[model samples]
Target: MTEYHGNVHVGGPVQTHELPQLMITKVAVGPMDNNAYLLRCRQTDEQVLIDAANEAGTLLRVIGSGGLARVITTHRHGDHWQALAEVVERTGATTVAGRYDAEGIDVPTDELLDDGDRIGVGQSTLEVIHLVGHTPGSIALLYDDPKGPPHLFTGDSLFPGGVGNTRGNAENFTSLINDVEAKLFARLPDETWVYPGHGADTTLGKERPSLPEWRARGW
Candidate 1:
């Protein structure tokens, strides 16, 4: 059974939820209300923060309380990459990002992950898949949960009602669609739960059948 541990709306801004055992905290940051996650292994207290935007203090506070181990970036967009350096310096944790967009983030990435690299946090090991198009070096985190359905952290690459915005010159809308259809939709089970960078949590089953619609709409 899935349990929600926290729903703290820091400063009446956005709702942040912490799911224990999983030790994951989802913080909504930035003017766009982007969600940055702080995940920790309950058993080991080793934590990881994904996507840093505004609220450097809040991010640091969450990490300090959770005992953060590292920070990981999904892409190089300013919304997700802005607070990365500060978080890294404050937490004293290594940063990891996709090889292609790594340079754009400007922080030194201790490890550059490719299509299929496994990263361990606490007891769970997450498999990283290169889901480019949103950015040349974007990656998605996939993990199999024994107690619950598997999860895919699609970064800015995939969302609840739609995929990520591909407005940048470096972004390819067509390639973004193709990557989601092939990498995300094809591999994971329809029941797999998705934790996107923005908006509400959704299941793969809810988003799959509408792929053609998303494609037709030109997202």
Candidate 2:
């Protein structure tokens, strides 16, 4: 049986937070307890939905009556996109995914993102960081917050306890750890917020010290 946090539920109240010019709304969905995020631009109200994981009706309601401008799939994982087709078809939102993972997804991708690509979210934008290993094209979105620490949408590339599963392969694990340390830990500050594809949120500061342990354990 899948365990879920107390806050994870259908029709759950959205957890909202302000990040400079962007407003983030997070909701947990699906049997796997995938987290779907709705990022709205404060200046223009243009919104983007990340990983419409499951429960299409709940996601549709979460977007409210305004609808969405684009739906971004974090990777090619089926669970991460169980609701993608429905949500996009219903809202007519443009679909975006990493260039390497686009062909694997069932939905047609409107935009192919690469590392250093900037996705405009009203006045602000999200920087794409393509992290390899768990999937060939797993990407994370970074938002630099002027008022506070930066925010990262890591998808399944990262989680609270450690990096996402690498199919128990040493090479894959090495690749993920290296990319995460170099691209994320080295580049971003410790206060950066990590919102993963599943489970509760965690901070880079909290997880940084455990890097060596994760390496030794070979997860």
Candidate 3:
């Protein structure tokens, strides 16, 4: 487990990042241990939840009295949205998903996200980056902080060790790798922080050198 800024707990509130204008909380839920993140804009108190994977009760508790502005699903994968319906119904938060995969989700999408679309979180804005291959509409959110390195929520497209599984399809693997390289690596700085759908977080700097290896392994 990666050491966050504050104390960490399983299926419990964890203050992962705190800045003057932004705050992030993470909780691991469901059998797959999917990570659900609550990103709050401190200045405006508006917030967004990323991947409401499961454990509605825990997620609700973590949300507390804060008003949830939106719930953004990174992809259409079942595991990434097990608790999405419950969460949306309970909070009445608008649900956002990529257009291509929106239809596949059980819940009706309130908004269709596209590449380059900007999502507001209080005073800050998250730039949506559509990285296809993991899913036709898989998207990642990029938060660029003026104070320091930028933050990236990659969903299942990119992980600490390598890219997400291509399901043994060479074309899919190639597409994912190309998107990661063109849309992410070639543009973003190495200091960018990567938060995935499941498991631990990692920095782009730490994973950049392994691109060749990842390609060689054909994952």
Candidate 4:
């Protein structure tokens, strides 16, 4: 069993975590050091790629020959979809993105995701969460593992120290923080693992205590 810590860097080795029914592979790519995740079903081998964030060759190499069912762009951010067109073209995978930010994505989104939507990867299911502020249509994915801790793929919404950037807009910051608190912090447990779009992974418990500070700082 390969120990999966979820700590990845550009040009570093990929880390894959094995759950009872699912396999999660994480890699860091692109100049921005964007993190891309590959979720595979142990039973059916069906797979989904989260954020084909740059390095089409690297992403394709990670994807391999098994092929991809869908590519979910967490948000419309350019960095997150830098390799979208190429990945989709090569894999012929269905493109999925948030409803509001779908227009911002360069490629056509086959499916427009909304809050409470469910996506399937073979036997496992990922719940869609619409988080505003970072982007009007930014989204996060929650995979409640049956045998282990819940996993969350947060695009640019929730990070380790604070929520994603909202620029100088107070309203956007407020919306992002509020949604994160009510939807993520309040609803999920501390053991939930968070896989952010960039940087290292963090648990909800590690970031829970500082929620108040994040709100008070108002950045």
> Per-residue lDDT tens digits of candidate 1, residues 68-165?
67788998887887788888877788889888988888778888988889888888788988876788999999877777678778888888788888
Ranking by TM-score: 4, 3, 2, 1
lDDT of 2 by residue, 102-209 (tens): 998998999999999989877878899999989999999999987788999999998888898999888989999999989999988889988999878888999999
Whole-model alpha-carbon lDDT for candidate 3? 0.89
lDDT of 2 at 172: 88
Root-mean-square deviation of every model: 2.9, 3.7, 2.1, 0.7
**Which whole-number lDDT from 0 to 100 does residue 103 have in model 3?**
94
Candidate No. with top lDDT: 4
Off by over 4 Å in 1: 1-21, 168-171
- Estimate, for each residue in 91-196, the C-alpha lDDT of model 4 and write its tens digit: 9999999999999999999999999999999999999999999999999999999888899999999888999999989999999999999999999999999999
After TM-score superposition, what is the CA distance of residue 10 in candidate 4 from its true location, in Å?
Answer: 0.7
Positional deviation of 206 in candidate 3, in angstroms? 0.1
lDDT of 4 at 86: 98
Candidate 4 lDDT trough over 10 residues, lowest sum: 1-10
Candidate 1 local distance difference test against the native = 0.78
Candidate 3, residue 58: the lDDT equals 87
What is the per-residue lDDT of model 3 for residues 1-219, given as tens digits with 9 covering 90 to 100? 454743334655565587667888878886887888999998888989999888888888888898799999999999988899889888999999998999989999999999999999989999999998999999999999988899999999999899998899999999999999999999999989888888888889999999999999999
Evaluation by lDDT, superior candidate among 1 and 2 = 2
For model 3, the run of ten residues with the poorest summed lDDT: 1-10
Which stretch of 10 consecutive residues in model 1 shows the poorest summed lDDT? 5-14
Clashing pairs in 4: none
Give the TM-scores of the predictions, in the order they appear: 0.88, 0.94, 0.95, 0.99
